[model samples]
Target: MPSSIFINQLYRPPSSSSPETLPSPNTGVRAFHQSLPGYKPSPLVSVPAIAARQGIRWCLVKDETERLGLPAFKILGASWATYRALGERLGLRENGDVVSLQRLAEAAKAEGVVLFAATDGNHGRAVARMAGYLGVGARIYVPSLLDEEAISKIRGEGAEVVVYDGDYDQTVLATKVAAENHAEGKGVLISDTALTVDDETANWIVEGYQTMFDEMEEQVLEITGTRTITHVVTPVGVGSLTQAVVTHFQRTPRSPKPMVIAVEPKSAACLKASLEAGEMTSVKTEYTICTGMCCGTLSAIGWPMLKSGISAAVAVEDSDVDTATKNLQSCGINAGPCGAASLAALESLSSGEELALGPQSVVVLLCTEGRRGYEMRSNSQPEP
Candidate 1:
């Protein structure tokens, strides 16, 4: 198998990261192995009782809260794409450190590099952290339901953060407006999902997810002693990380790839509607307990990956998220609404019995983020 496959192709492992093998027009696809060194893998914990009580024997938790000091899965995709996009523009290799992001920000400031994105919590934080570390000024648009603590963390990362009027989907539109209003040139929108391919940032973000699958593969081996994943679940807000998982795993040794499930809130099931409609579509996003799943529109880049028969999208209730949060904590793990959405979907799936939960099949859930989302979970109102 090749070290890395093309963006459209399936997953394959090339030899470990090598400077000579970095993807080039001449060399084809290259792994960004050394591009960002010191990446520690996320731990995959076993939820035996959670699985057993749910009528399944076991479930694996791909805990990503500890990624690069961030408490979410957003960094896996965002950081990978950021470095790759910068590397391409500057003629740098995967092994090359190239120009520091701080220096590039100064130069980019002349040209005006302003990052933009709408998030419930994690995605915006990832963008803010990346832009701050790279020295580029960024304006992150977020919903009113966004946690103050998460926003403060993003602000600490040096991005000018804006709390928009409504939900995550509305914030996405507001962000587009902010990026277009960049008269001083500080508004280059760094969105993860869109139809146009001109911005290579999303693709790079997806690359960051590759390392995630790499970590997941290790966990699968250590826990199961075999790499065959039967079913996988991931929470979707923007779908960048979800798409990356599908893309990476689809290329692996599992020919009939695991049943990839998309977990979203029923109140704002953009990806769910898109899947049912068989196109990139949007749903009427209402204020819900699961603020993260309140994304109104589907990310165009991520939709194609989903529509390719790689996923089974499902809308989960708020109670499941609440229960999952408490469940994770009970198991000594911290996961917020967005992070627990995957497990929530699993519960729904378990009840649905569509995928048939049993001991023979190994289920993997992407515990995407930490309790930084605790502030925004709308427990005051009724469940979704």
Candidate 2:
């Protein structure tokens, strides 16, 4: 494999001042989600062989392949954000009061409200799924590079899919503009990324992702007899999921904070570049095989938390991702490109001196998605 990993240590311990803190995820988010039908925790899987090979004590993959019937973990955030946004609009404030999809649909219809967003694939599909559940209209914008299978999936959920002849950032801008131009009370932009840190919907999106970490806390203890997560490796597109991981570990009262490693495609290393420049930055990117992670800009809503929370950020090539995906397959874990990027980062760090991996370290990789119709491998067979 060609060496294509660039690592940057963004945070160091014994800092002069404390990092900015966000509101902790309350029990209400968990209760609301658990109340929904078919709400089960995704598996926290251990790959002993891979851990042994990497000279680590344990390697856990948070298998989010089938979260809430969605192919990717994006649904966790999208659904939560959608519920909160719609709930506020409908004047439903009490946490104990269950807001059913029927109630949401009736309110949305009466108020002429529609959910809108721009996505590379998974997030848009998730928002569409939520809209479908609520029997509301959904308008999703996608870049020209999105695969046909993903587009079909979004449309299959009864969402109006609009393909933009621009890159992901441009598509996001267009969606934002459209939402602003929509008739009064007709459109609600439920974007995971925004230009402002105080974007309520975007903040809610990050909070929505807290459910995954809550599950991980319980499952990690049950499986490992300890709640300490030494290291976390996850892909960074807009950094929403990564921010959630950082917040969860930082806010947990007794648990030791994990070293967060953010992975991105070499073609779109926005977060890495931003950290290097010491400011929010944007990059021009081409089509990368890791399509889901092809983001050029860091999310304004997520950057502050990621900047202060992540230990390091890495940019890996597409070939590295392919190797990682296959390696994960050998361990019986199916991961899409973006999902496998976490494993690729782990492999890179294992051979380097930047992040230590020893018998005491417990590493958790986020397998954010599974292979849908867009299969990157020829056969689904595992290597011996």
Candidate 3:
């Protein structure tokens, strides 16, 4: 499929009296993250080369390559949601101490409580890692098309990896059913995506991503001595992370709220399709190198926010992602195909005036993952 970009006609700023609002800089979530081992803010880097090539003042990347010892930002959402979902059952308190967490792990193990989740890659590994921290077990479900390296990483975290013979959305349903049917050991679903907007666990997962933006805002201020971010480019899998971007930039009282551009694989551009249809729509996704963004459907909870808040949606072909990966790697930023999709989207949008990016514009690309191995679906060689 050819690459395309859609300007959201429904895009509008948040009204001062709007009831739909997500809180900014959630301190409690940040504090919880700070208490975890290997906790530190991911770097917000300015790539001058990219900015010059793209004709922007600065092209900043919020590098999530090494967040909490994981290769992606999925850990931020998975860990936070797991804590909120199973905290009481495992006797965990806010900012729970390491010793108390260890003791509660033993209690949780005796009680047979387990964490259940489905992912293309990063989220499942994160859930398994969280399960290890709490001395419980985890069962991670993945689509049959996922790469072996991703599956191996999840299994290495001591979780049982189940292969579902379907796409990502179907795998999520299978995982939900398995979690619901595991009558012996208590299973708690810690999914980040949902079929309905009211899924509490999914909402909590969205809340868990607050720390990333909080850190980005502080870092941007420290580096630029200003808070005038004109654009935030984010990759959309199920739209949960895009929802977080809109919540952080739109809800702020800051004037001229940053325009959010959501990027997705051309074959799996579900959010872009939904935005053009003026209603939530699902598409049949084809194979793409950006496996992480290969979701076929949009999260219901994120539709309203994304449709109204996102300035534009860009869907890029695998070749575009390959070029982006090479560009980022040349700069010593080990961004995978999915993570580099934001750069590709920016390139697509910059070709026209839809974005209105200027010399003073400081664009932040949310690079959600580091480089990983994957088979090339196109005729071109796989990203190195």
lDDT of 2 at 116: 95
> Against the hidden reference, what TM-scores do the models get?
0.81, 0.92, 0.93
RMSD of each: 7.3, 4.5, 3.0
Each candidate's lDDT (Cα)?
0.68, 0.82, 0.86
As a TM-score, model 1 comes out at 0.81
RMSD of candidate 2 to the true fold?
4.5
Indicate the TM-score of model 3: 0.93
Which one is best on lDDT? 3
- RMSD (Cα, Å) of candidate 1? 7.3
- Show where candidate 3 strays beyond 4 Å: 1-3, 15-25, 88-100, 351-353, 379-384
Q: Estimate, for each residue in 1-384, the C-alpha lDDT of model 3 and write its tens digit.
A: 434988888888654426344654556788878878999999999899999988888899999988999999999999888877776655566465323455656777788998999999999999999998988889999998888999999999999999999999999999999999887749989998987868877887888899998898899999889987989999999999999888877666677778899999888999999988999999987778898888999888999888898989999889889899999888878999989999999887654466779788889999999998766676443322
Order of candidates by TM-score, top first? 3, 2, 1
Clashing pairs in 2: none
lDDT of 1 at 84: 55
Off by over 4 Å in 2: 1-10, 14-20, 95-98, 351-353, 373-384
Name the candidate, 2 or 3, with the larger TM-score value.
3
Candidate 2 lowest-lDDT run of ten: 375-384
Better of 1 and 3 by TM-score: 3
Residue-level lDDT of model 1, residues 319-338, one tens digit each, is 77888888888987888777
